[model samples]
Target: MKKLTMALIALPILAIGTTTIAGMKYASDDDRCERGERYSQEDRQKRNPDKMVERLAKKLELSQTQKNEVKQLFINKQQQRETMREQMQSLHKTLRGLDPSAADYASALAQAKQKAAFMAESKIDERMHMKAAMQKILSPEQMAQFEAMQSKRKHHQGMER
Candidate 1:
């Protein structure tokens, strides 16, 4: 009887735990748009630069000219980002290829770290420049709204898009 009772208790507990976990997974996709908090997707289609610009244009109520300008800007930035990604990937592969027993491993690793630090600085500078460029393109009212939206995204995503 005790064994049966324990099994019964365990079954419901397991079911509830699974249900809670499943709910959490779906919850992550829910956007609190009213609060200016968006749950960005990692999907390749959603991350496409042109699609992102379209979303931005709709949200900011951008004129056709402004939308074209922002689209061009995003395209340029995306190209630059791809280059940086390739460089970072090379650095990552180099680090992965190093053998711990190699005498030069430490020095080689240090140099990679130095390169990574410079890349990080470059990324920050590029982000600032992009923000400035966007602000220049936007009207004052649109810029304020854009800033608010960006600030919220930064709060959620560690200042990354």
Candidate 2:
């Protein structure tokens, strides 16, 4: 009787454990965020530069000329970003191949740091250019709305954390 009771208890426990694991596996594909902030794949894709400009254009009621100029600005920035990504990838691969404890590792690390700093500076410059373009294209009212939207986005990101 004791053996049968133990088997009965074990069966339910095993079932529960399996159900939990299955739920986790299903949730991960839908919810996993490497940065720990949740966003769906399509939502993230819509935030890409072109889509973001389209979204902003709709919000601000941009003229056709303004939209074209904004699109070109973002395209330029995207090209710069792609170039930086390639350089960073090369630097990372080089760093990965070097032995940490080796005598040459210090020089390799220094080179990687320099590349990273340069890339960071370039990114900042691109952002400044984008901001300047936005200011030139958007009216005061539109700019104010844009700033508010940015603040709201920042607040939400903070809340998610």
Candidate 3:
């Protein structure tokens, strides 16, 4: 009877502890970068593609095919994002290497501005493509759930800001 009583008491405490831990948000890579800190290994692993797909599959009750499709989609998105990131880095390098005293400074600056705008547009294009592809891939119910999840995430992110 004493053991039973202790177990009952411990159960609720354990539940509370787990709930609190689950509710806490950790810093993302972008947040760490903006704060001039490095992303910890744990955070990097959290963003791994397989981990993300597994989480989504569990949340949405995805079938094997859906899981594979979503995983591929994520891979494609990451590749496209990396390409854009490389371009942005190159643009920054170009601007940084330019001599302010040089006559071509203004022209280089103008070219950089154009590239920046193009990158911004490319981002929008990627977003639209992803949305369209997801709509085609996810069923109505899953799409609704996915959109709701996205909305909640955006809301939480906005509150952080």
- Runs in model 3 lying further than 4 Å from the true structure: 1-34, 38-46, 159-161
In model 1, which regions exceed 4 Å deviation? 2-45, 156-161
| Candidate scoring better on TM-score of 1 and 3 | 3
Per-residue CA lDDT of candidate 2, range 28-146, in tens?
Answer: 55555544655555754554777867898999888888888888877777667668877877978887898998998888888888888888888898778878888998888988998
Q: Candidate 3 — which pairs collide?
A: none
TM-score between model 2 and native: 0.70
Error of 2 at 137 (Å): 1.4
- Runs of candidate 2 exceeding 4 Å displacement: 1-50, 159-161
Error of model 2, residue 128, in angstroms: 1.4
How well is each residue in 80-134 modelled by candidate 1, as lDDT tens digits? 8778988987999998998889999899989989999999999999999998999
Candidate 3 on 68-146: residue-level lDDT in tens? 9989999888778768878988988988898889998999889989989999998999999999988888999999999
**Shift in Å, residue 105, candidate 3:** 1.8
Candidate RMSDs in order: 7.1, 5.0, 12.2
Using Cα atoms with residue i matched to residue i, what is each candidate's TM-score against the true structure?
0.69, 0.70, 0.70
Summing lDDT over every window of 10 consecutive residues in candidate 2, give the lowest-scoring window. Answer: 32-41
lDDT of each: 0.84, 0.80, 0.84
